[model samples]
Target: MNNAHYELQDGIAVIRLENPPVNGLSYELRRGIVDGIKKAEADDNAKAVVIIGSDRAFSGGADITEFNTPKVMAEPTLPTVINVLDSTELPVVAAIGGVCMGGGLELAMGCHFRIAHPQTQVALPEVKLGLLPGAGGTQRLPRLIGIEYAMNLIVSGTQVPAAMFQGTPLFDELVEGDLLESALTFAKKVVEEQRPLKRVRDMKVSHPKPEAFFLWAKTSVGAVAKNYPAPLKCVEAVKASIEKKFDDGIKLERELFAQLIQTPESRALRHAFFADRAAGKISDVASDTPTREINKVGVIGAGTMGSGIAINFLNAGIPVTILEMKQEALDRGVAHIKGVYEGRVKKGKMTQESAEKKMGLLSTTLSYDDFKDMDLVIEAVFEDMGVKQKVFETLDATCKPGAILASNTSTLDLDKIASFTKRPEDVIGLHFFSPANVMKLLEVVRGEKTSKEVLATSMKLAKKIKKTGVVSGVCDGFIGNRMVGKYQTEALLMIEEGASPQQIDKAIEKFGFVMGPIRMADLAGGDIGWAIRKRHYEEKPDTRRLYVADRLCEMGRFGQKTGAGFYKYEPGNRKPLHDPEVDRVIEEVRKEQGITPRKISDQEIVERCVFALVNEGARILEEGIAQRASDIDIIYLTGYGFPVFRGGPMLYADEVGLINVERALQKYRKQTGNPFWEPAPLLAKLAAEGKTFN
Candidate 1:
């Protein structure tokens, strides 16, 4: 009696789901729904039953926390609750308003008819979390929509707008007004006309050759999924619907869902999903801090980094003023911005009109007078302390009072940049990844004197620009590039010690990196690394040198732009063309170091490259540069091209076991005699105690 809310209107039974916030189908809500259906079935006066939700959303999905609990997996689960809705003899109509996802969609599918408002979103996003539709979703979706569309939706886990279902058989009617009134009207029409019940499971599979569906799905599964078993397993579950009986398909889906829940990929993906959400919560900053609203922004550079940062602000509907010293440089920057926007237009991502509108948001100027009244100024000049300090001093003198000052320094010190300005409290780092408009990770560096207000304002601006803002303390390379330098150094050393560049690249590529170390270095331009190395040497000449490869840069082999670095590249194609010249250079370097060439295994190469990064990440964590291990994972997954299926470096380390990693590092340290291979103390302690980063 407590579970069901019975209301009689005319001769119809009204059952409203009384749960809050998307009506997540918890254990109590499931039982309440079942009892509501039973009440409608037993009432003689109720000619029809109309089920609706009081909240904006019908239901979000099954409770995520319930998945780990034992009580949920027992008898009378979600499937049983769906069965009660399916068994109702009277005409039943479901009124859906907001999000109807997962179990919410399953409940609507069981109804005799469904009506929804124009703003509702429908999806089965279980595949994103490494799961398939368990409660009749696999069996019913294909029956409502065809096999091809159903497979794509379930496999990709994409949500579609409710307007797309207009005039489709999936939804009975698209309501413009109240969802309940529409449901009631539809129910009255159905009862009066004595509409026949159409069960999804009873519908025959529409494909002419069902075997072809399985074959195509299998091909797609192999190409996209590679070694990961979850996506392929999802394909198999969907295939069951076309190949087997409805009940058999449901059983296969359940088995696959249960198996995937225990997989490393699923666990890692779930961790990543929640980690991204958790990054927004900062304990240091009060929620009440006044966010410096960024309307008009200024970028102090015209190079690649500055132009990309300006593009992001423009794309976000914020006006930008790109300041450069020379008219020729300003013209080149404008041309580059137009080219980038034109590429987007060519790909059908944006229209020509929209591109022109975005370009109109940008105003190029040569003087700091144009920066007046700007809300934020981001300095993205060359990585030099004097050049950066000059820009900061100029910005401090010209910018509007209380305007947030940001620097886009990848590895330079933020505290030193703040030292040049009188308002050190306002100076913060907004280190966007290369090609800032495309990359999602934005390292928000907080200097020693950076105020909490400035930190909060920087994060707010990062979110506004559609970037994941990860806060980091001041360090040489901050968090990402610092760890990357160590990883890249290890890969280069491996090449010096007889490992082939292609072999090393292939090993890590197999481990889910988009490209290997040498290939990535080539793509990012060798000049950048050369510049950083030169700066490092100039600043501290006596600081332990680790055999630099100056020959590559001297020969003008500055990666893909110059067509050669550690590998050769063809114009217009990203594929690496192995060069005999590079091999000769390696041989000459190897002789200079007096190293005997030895064969290197793929296993050893992967361990050296990946574990080196993980080891450095541990050091960053120990130094308090990174707040959490998950934050490091987020940076790699979003910023770097680290594969999502394996999670990030930290997750991979946990999977490999710290003890095994520490042993490898110790063995390599002794063999190579490189101080960089010294395992981090936290890594050693974790290995000794047999613990994980989590």
Candidate 2:
């Protein structure tokens, strides 16, 4: 059957696109559309043409699978298809609903008139994939929606509801319901009125004082768009629309779009887009695996982590029962949850009623009996094994049969925790990032005996709470923290070798990290890492005990909580300030070790810290802790604030050429004489083979 079907109704020829899901405009669909339009033009009884899509989408732009392929530019390309629609003698009206984006929107704008359902979302999100709209979107959107508004939508790649643009020329009319009937009524009226065929290309695009407006826009867009070239290209395209003829403007748009598609930044962004989707798939679990229902959740402990975890379930409209040993701790946790809602209400993000409704799902308790009926119970107690084991043992005994037992432990052995429960298959790790309510990453650590249903259900639940869930196999620190451990270790070692905290932070920040390791450590609390390190030292006796971190802990500098960490903080101020006393301590520690400090270059610092991550990530790949290299990238890009433009560490290493990365590690291995600098076997082998992790 043809992807697009042509049918006549009451003197109006309706063209319905039949491609499943979002009807991606491939060559076949493009041909079908062109044929539909010609059939309407040829039909003696048909007075008008109405082009639309399946209930799901009008068109979701060009078929991405056809990208960089000859079929994309085959007979009747997107531009050629749009041209045929524009030339049709009948009044062609676009009936848009669901998703209309990129070339889809461009196709709609090519028609004589456009209308959509009220809730339909419209966007030209090509910029998000590191390319501007190639199909006259830059030129036509401004003509219909004004220069400033078009620039905002095109540059930021934001989605807007069709209702928001009711008065704009982009939409001829918005139907309440039954789009076909309303469109038929609209088309018949157009026939009666003898409405002339209109084209977006014929419309004049104008901006008030074009030269001055463009100048101001360039300066503002340039400020936040240092790394991305597409947004600025979007600016230049829109600017050309205002200055040049319509045909010239579109020519400029196509040129800029083609150029961006080939750039490395665009390639990285495209890779990131695919990586995020691929992260959700587990190799062992089928996509059709059944997930257990999750209605009620129980959180053990009412500390910061527990409270944050509870808020996620509550926000998802799932009832949450939080258990704490003391009423004081429970009160504080409950109050913090309320305070969060109150803050959102004050910020105008949520109404008082909505906040109350979300808070209504929350309850606090002092007994595990309160969790007897919960579908899932997550223990967010102390990170120590003994405490977690005890909590899980009690939960396994208390929670009803088949209930999932989860631990929010960041760095402990998940398999050991799972063993504590009688039903090991039900025990999994839901490693939410700190301040769980805000962060998107949820590392669903699957134990050795974890059932496929439990893994599938945990992933489903993660989605309900609006998190990007990545599955991890049993291992210390799992995916994110495991790699971050190396990143942090290198930073501490770098500081000891003479790079100051501020200099190290600045160098990484310049390289695209949100915060340097030192600043992030200060924010997360230095004590957290100190405890983890102590565990490591115990597990592996050869681990160093007297690092610079231990000295900072001994000085009672925990982090933002203590107001003095590696860097000092004044009362009520969380910003790090240079402390000469800390410098003195570093010098004293260096003198005690009988080693003189030497100046370290920023390049060396980046190599040490980043190469540490790459090497550890390589080991993770070999061990099957992560499903693929892209999964590791997803963990870092979403959780650890890895630079999006450079892609993730694994991709970044591949881009840097594994040979160069191997050379860098070999250099550090020889120069620093630290066993940590030794290259992973996988990294060395890949470098030798001239291959990438991807």
Candidate 3:
């Protein structure tokens, strides 16, 4: 069946787009629109034409599922359908409501006239997928609106209300209510008045100081989009609008779009986009699984992590009761929560009243008694098993039956944590990244004993709190932390050999990470890693110790908190400055180990660090710790600041070719003689078979 419905309403030919859930313009939908336009043109009873969609979306643009598929470029493509609309002699009015983005807006621009709901969200967000609008968006948008406004919308990929374009030629009318009625009336009026076919291509586009403006735009966009080439291409496409004729401008836009599609940056972005969506789906857990209600939440501890966790639920409008051991600690936690809201208000992100309203949902106490009625209780106490045991035992005793007992443990085993509670079935892990309120990733650890209902509820709650929840089976560090351990180990090993912290950081940062491993370690606090290493010493004595990091901890150069780490931080400043003292310490440690310093290449640094992650990730996939390779990618993308333009380690390895990655691992193994440098079985097998991680 066609994805559109055509009918004669009054005297207007109404062709309503019927693709549900944002109405992505898939091939079938594109074909339906083309057929409807033909039918409208042939009908004698129809006065004019109106194209409409559901209340949720006018159209959300090209179907992502169809990307990299032949169906995306099938006959009657989005551009072809829009060409039909442009050619039609009869007045075609786009009655847009809800989301009208990318090709949807491009399609609307092709029509004779346009009317939209004031609240409709409009954008050309193709830039986010490392692309410019390929279907006449660049050529037509500047013709409707000015160059500056159109360029800003396309390059930034931000959404704005359709009302923002009310006075512009982009919208003929902005209706606040009953969009269909207004559209039909507008269509009839167009017919009665014999309005000429108003194609956007016929309109003139001009800009003041066009040369200067485009030059500045290119430079600015280039700086912001340092690694990715699409944003700069977007500027070029927009520049073509005024520099060339309409058809010629569209040709340039298509050429640039095609070039970007072939780029690895664009490929990686598309992979990440699909991987993010894939991460939410569990193979064994049915999408329609019933989830337990989580209306009231109880948080144990009032430290930074605990407070951040509470803020998330409070922001989501859930009532929270935060418990602490002492009243002073409780007061401090409450103050921290208040300060966060106050800061938001000060930044003009929210109203003071709104902040107060959210804070009003918080209840602070020093007793487990307050958690009796909580639907869910998450313990964000110290990451000690003994402390966790006490907290869970108390929560199990105090919380109402069936209340989910979740632990906010980053590295501890979820199964062991579940064993602490009597209702192990109600236990799950909700591992929030540092600064929990702002981070996007939440590893929803599905313990062996965790009920499907509880697991589903945790996933649902992750979405409710606006987090990208990637499910991980219980392991020492789950997926992200486990892989990162190997990544950090390689970085430390490089530093010990010859590479300075600065060189290692710059290499990885250049490789597209937001921050380098050494900088991240310093910012996160050297003490934290030291503690983890101490534990590793007891648990796995055979594991090699990172002596340099241990020596730094001994020096009490904790991090930004203590004002000194691998690099010195000036008071109130986060910039990492070179310290001669740090260099001296490194040299001393190297001497003690009877190791001679040798120059290491940046390429070697990047490979050792990133490949370490890929190797561990392969093991993670083999062990089923991560359900799929894409899930691991999501963890790194959302949690670990992995470059979105390189996809994630797994996909990056695939792009690098697993054979090349295995070769690099072998090279490292022979040079370093480290057992950990060995390629994972999965990686080796995939390389041998000439298969990708996918």
Candidate 4:
């Protein structure tokens, strides 16, 4: 298909890119632009040139599909095409609208003049993929705009509307009408007056006390850069445009861009970019599947989870009705949700009127009859199966016909819950993470009888509430929590074997996790997991085992709420302070098991925790609980605080080599006579065959 098209308008040669969706500059598109420029320059009748794109997008960026392919560096690259456009004799005007970003913005910079609509979103966001702009973006952008503005834009990879730069030289005019017509008129004015070529390359990058500002910028960028190097490199490249000559800065930009592309951080970030996009697609569900309209939502229970769940739909502009057994309980739930919004208002993150508007969408009830008008009803009651069955059965009888009934059960069986209702197809799970309005993950649990329309609508509603929706087959703990169960188990086992909570947390934190399992357990409250563990033992008797966590709950120390758990916390501070009493509890458990404590290394702690996630993830894949390896990565990255720089646990395992992982598991099995360390069959097979999950 023709990615770029050329047409003649009066005496102006108009070149427009036709790549559907986003007009990514591919090899063919580059060739078209280069050839079109040459054709326009050769024709004496064409006194000027105008370039434009469709209303949705002028261009988003370079065609990432061409990355690492011969087509990317194939002759007539983006720079080559831009160079010809920059040096063209006929005056050219860039007409920008929608999303014009990265290489697209770079191409616009090459034109003699630019005209855009006020709402045009313009950005150079290569920094998000862990690389600087390779094709003259860092060099030319600073020359057109000032160096400081260029630094902030390139470093953050943030979008700025064309109107934000209205008075700036980056755009010659802002057109509210047809951008193409305005651009053509701008081109005619340039030709009528015979305006000299206004190439961005000839412009100078100015700054007051350049050396001083760069010194400050380096220190600032370095502080926030953390494990990622691309942001700092972005600052350096923009600095080069000011310190070095323009051509020399271009060379340095290429060198820095090439260096960053090879880093593991860059590879992981690129994987993340693709994984997030791929997670939304369910292969079995066709794109044309009709979704149920969720105009109103209902939530049962007035506890933390249910209240938070109501806040999500309310924030999404959907009216929410929450039910409780008593009027006081209902009032408390409403107060908590309102307090969250009020806090946002006090923080200046939202206006008082805006917060009130959102809170106004919420309603409370004491009877199931009020849920009759709700298009969807989510039960966020306790984790007990009996409670869930009662809720589902009542919802089954009381809800309006065609209403989607969803359970917010994190680890419970969705299929069994579906069995409580006659229309099992309408019953699915919308597992929102803790503090639902704040966290991004929404694991849409698909039961055995879940209809495609229901599953699709749940995913759609997830996006409506600003959540990253990942579909998971009905299973105990679903995907994120199921894998985390194993991960936490490793931490517990390591503690029993010898390592202290601080030691394990330190090793994992150094490995890049923000919160270690022990600290996470404490923050979430040990009583939560203690209850879950009790439930596990009740449901599956054979897996019953005594552990140190039960001791913490027995002492009535439940995380931040109780001011103590595995660690002690000072009144206001949430920082974990080591407790010898907790260590004594662990020591007593080890003595009860008739085992002596052994010295454990940080490497073992890191391996056992991360590999535990990997092993369960493999089993999940083989069981078809997760769609693909990348989808699992997305779940962990978004839901849990798995380090983004390592991709997800599955991708990290692939990076570590599955063979090495199997060997480590075998070593642990031999060290401790536990059958749980046995390598998953899928993992062992993949390792032997030399394969990656992705």
Candidate 5:
């Protein structure tokens, strides 16, 4: 019931923040801190006040639950609470441990003294949410530490250990012992010595060559600020700490925070922040559902995907046994994993001893017998159904009774794959993105018959392996690929209609995609999309054709692997070069189709490609393929290189306005005469009602 507890011991008053998970400095906690300080002031015997929190967190930051609500800016706001602590006559000591960040650090700096655990994670992470620290963080931090360190910490939103600031005024003492004990002893000393109540606001912040330094900071931050304006604003706010008085700096910080939060870029980043957390929850599955243990993992095949999957388990300290059809293949897989660890070692990302320890958890096998003891077996074999069927059949017979049988199939029918095993309830799809170990997405495909227990465990395992697992119902290509198909198709169609591959790619990249679809196709190997299209041509005879892509593949131009596709690459260099041959090929296809090429604007290119994804994502949401609109955003943001600032295609569509999106779809549908451009029913409905997806 009490968010903060008040106690008195030997003339010392202690205010212990009691919010669980993380003392997030909620209104209640803020009031409690103020009330405790008041109580300390009133007590004749209380000589000093000590503020503390649990070892897990002195405070993580602002209470995210209160975000976007009036509660966040209610009376006794973070600044008000900090101001209370700052003006208090008695010396206040902040005993910080574990995580203390954002307004939490601001609160600590408001105190007269700070004693922290050496490993306490300290940060002013508001810039990550597209805002500067609004509560004296920029003003006080530069005063405690130098301008340079404060600039880096506030702008980057990166966490540094308290030990890193050992000799700095940020932490009066870095304690390796019990935090509260050190704080109580320090408070006693402060009382005995009658120490002055130090205020960070009174401290001066100076920077040599202030104008030149700030000019360089702006230029450096500008280069990476991209579509997000928060980083540069952060620089401005930090510079103000030196240029302006303390209260004036605080006012400037508030102004910048307000301006940044209202920007579309900041809104998108905030949406993405919430969307990632939302993806981890499954509505039908209770949070308390029991999950099966996955102490040992078995990975089928020894190719790139399989080896990468095995490395995830090995890195998680879970023993992984990789099965390959041949000993030579097994040897190559093992060697590839070793080389990856060796690369990390050489780069100093990890020590050789640590790499060796991870490798020690990895073992190779030639048969399924080794999988019997595996609690979870993931098959990363060929994507063909026949190949998957055989792997599932073998695993069905080989793995133990409760073992989770997962397939890393990207587009295959998960239900059919599950049918290969009698225990269909245990079969689920753990679709890892390419370079499985590197990419963050893991689409946990929940089949028609997947048990709740298995689904819960699969989600848990995804987190354990450090992947953003988004749940998807059974559907061809599931969520990410299904939407990406439309995205890439629009790009190809634009090329057919006259836009160059480079032009289309540049437009999308300019819109903030990590890579353009045409360049992405080249990087992913054009043959892969060509093969899928061939399958589509057979399965859906009336499917819209992408002739130019097929013609390029017909010429044996796969991608970077084949030294050419839509673009050519120099040996040992991944940069794609302009291939005049590809231009000629595009012309030939256009002539064959009797299509007249028209110059397309970059705006058209971006809208067509991005809105194509938005329309398909609408359909996916309508069909219940994706749990919510945000899940689609998460999949695209993490796996498909959708711009985080745009909050992925779905959220971007909402930001663009559903009615506007519907209008664009109608315009493109008529202009292009492509049936795929037709607005999805849900999109039209939402637009008619003037509602957003999220």
Candidate 6:
């Protein structure tokens, strides 16, 4: 009874949905709604009816938790309750506010008329969960808004403001304030003027060329959807409106919804959604740990990484101070930021005024003297530990006592950097991915002496900057790059055994990688891997080492930036072109090693690269460096361009079976005699037992 609040005033029945926190359509709430509508229809005092919510949001959608439970899916259906609301003789008006999504929007479409607040937004986001709208949404939305707009909304799962609905015949009226009062006024107008009620399902499809719309939709959604089945199913639901009768279309939608609910893509996408929400939870760090409120930040470098990090802070409305040793370098960094903003403006992502406002937040200087009173300072200089340590030492003396100190070191030791600081507990690692502003993953490394307050503050700051922060204990390469190193080394060894760079690249790309390891190295610059390789050789000299490809770097053939590396690049175009010189260099290296390279199959190449990463991930999990397998999956999907449709490397491995992965590793170990091919003990044990990472 509490879920539904009913009152009769002046021969008008007002029914309000009272479920708190977005008013998700739960089982009890549905039953209460059906009973309330029947009571209003039978009462002589009630001449008409109005349905709305008590507070700001009308409804956020169906209770997502309900999908995980068996009771809701197995018990009394949602359609039965929806039919009760739709069939009532009295006129029913939905007064919507805030977000009306999923089943909430379906309920609104069932009403005779909809009155929305000016700021209200409506969407059916079922596609995000790999399900189509089940309860008359796919059938009704097209009827009310037409095919094109409806298809776009369903496919993208994007919401629009109520203002866009203005001048549209679907909405009866747009209300400004006090949604209940506006609903009552509209209800009285309908009764006094004897207005005819219009149901969305009863309306016919409206389009000049219905077949052309269907053809265009199939082509557009198919291109973007790839292996995912939800987008194409959404198109089928829309096409059903034109091809089938109203009730028949609803039946088709229900059938498709049930089928999609059982797909592996749906389960994976839903798992990802829940995993993202769960990533914010940190049990070791107290919830109330005091955070250093960062209103202004200072950056110690003006290179690519530094500029990209500055753009992230500026976009979040935090003022930034960038410092470079040379004035020319400072000018270039500023120009790069401006160019990025101008491109965004041209694409209508931002207005010129908005771009200027963000730019105004940035301040540049050549010395540390201008960094006074800054709440946080991020050092994004070279990869050398000595350079980073020197920056930490300078920042320790320059920054205020309570300010947070962070280093953007991808592979350097955070504990070593903390050792140089007077307040070692305040130092942390904020490893932003390359092209920092665009990449969503941020590895927040906690040094051995890192304080709980520092960890909590970094997590909160990641949310403020709109990035996914995964807390990682300090180790070599933290989480992502540490696993990446194992995978990349295996790929290079494959090349030594006669797999061409193109073959390796093509194999992984077919397996759903956005780019192969060799091409990624090209884009990141060949010098980066060469430098890291040199450092590794210095630290662990006894390990079997691959011959260095120094000619590429010595000739200034860095990568796409230098127009050549593993592959040749045309100016202004980043596409890879084969070069015989690179192949000749590789052949010479193979000859020096006394290795007779043979032709490698595509399947062998994919398993070597991807399984290597998954095998390393298992090691990380056993060592407790990563909290969960899903955490690694989220990191790869967001940062390393692992295809989302395939889930992630870990998920993909699970799909392929753990035993198969172990067998592949064993086969490689026997063939190559490389110690790195030794299947992780955990992986071998799990595979033997037929268990999975989950």
CA-lDDT, candidates in order: 0.84, 0.89, 0.91, 0.90, 0.92, 0.86
Per-residue C-alpha lDDT of model 6 across residues 572-679, encoded as one tens digit per residue: 999999999888888888888888989899988888888888998999888888888888888888899887776777887888899989889889889878777798
For model 5, residues 1-694, the per-residue Cα lDDT tens digits are 4589999988899999998889988888988999999999999999999999998999998888888888898888989999999998999999999899998999999999999999999999888888888999988999999999999999899999999999988988888878888899999999899888889999998887889999999999999887889999999899998988999999999999889989988898889899989999999999999999989998998999999998888889999999988999999999999999999999999998999999999988887888889999999887788898888898899888999999998888999999999999999999999898899999999999999999999999889999999999988889888888888999999899999999999998999999999999998888878878888899999998899999989999998999999999999999999999999999999999999999999999999989989999999999999999999998999999998888888889888899999999999989978888899999999999989999
TM-score, every prediction: 0.93, 0.97, 0.98, 0.97, 0.99, 0.94
Candidate 5 wrong stretches, greater than 4 Å: none
Misplaced by over 4 Å in model 4 are 67-69, 544-546
- Pairs clashing within candidate 5: none
TM-score of 4: 0.97
lDDT tens digits, residue span 426-530, model 3: 999999898999999999999999999898899889989999999998888889988898999999988999999999999999888999999999988898888
Residue-wise C-alpha lDDT for candidate 2, range 1-694, written one tens digit per residue: 4678889998999999887778999888899999998898889999999998866898999887777689888988888888898888889999998989889999999999988999999999999989999988999999999999999999998999999888989998998888888888888988999988888888887766888999999999999988999999999999998889999998999999889988878988988888887888888899999999999899988888889999899889999999999999999999999999999999999999999999999998998888889999998888888898788888888989989999898989988988887899998999999789988889999999999999999998888999989989888888889989889988888778888989999999999998899999999998999999888898899985547888998888888889888888999887889988778878888888876789999999898888899999999999999989998888888888888888889999999999999999999999978887789999999999999998
- With a 3 Å backbone cut-off (N, CA, C), the pairs that clash in candidate 3 are none
In model 3, what is the error at residue 491, expressed in angstroms? 1.3
TM-score of 1: 0.93
Q: Report clash pairs, candidate 4.
A: none
Task: List, residue by residue over 366-439, the lDDT tens digit for candidate 4.
Answer: 99999988899999998889999999999999988899999999999999999999999999999998888789
TM-score of 3: 0.98
Candidate 6 whole-model C-alpha lDDT, 0 to 1? 0.86
Candidate 2 residue 683 Cα shift, in angstroms, is 1.9
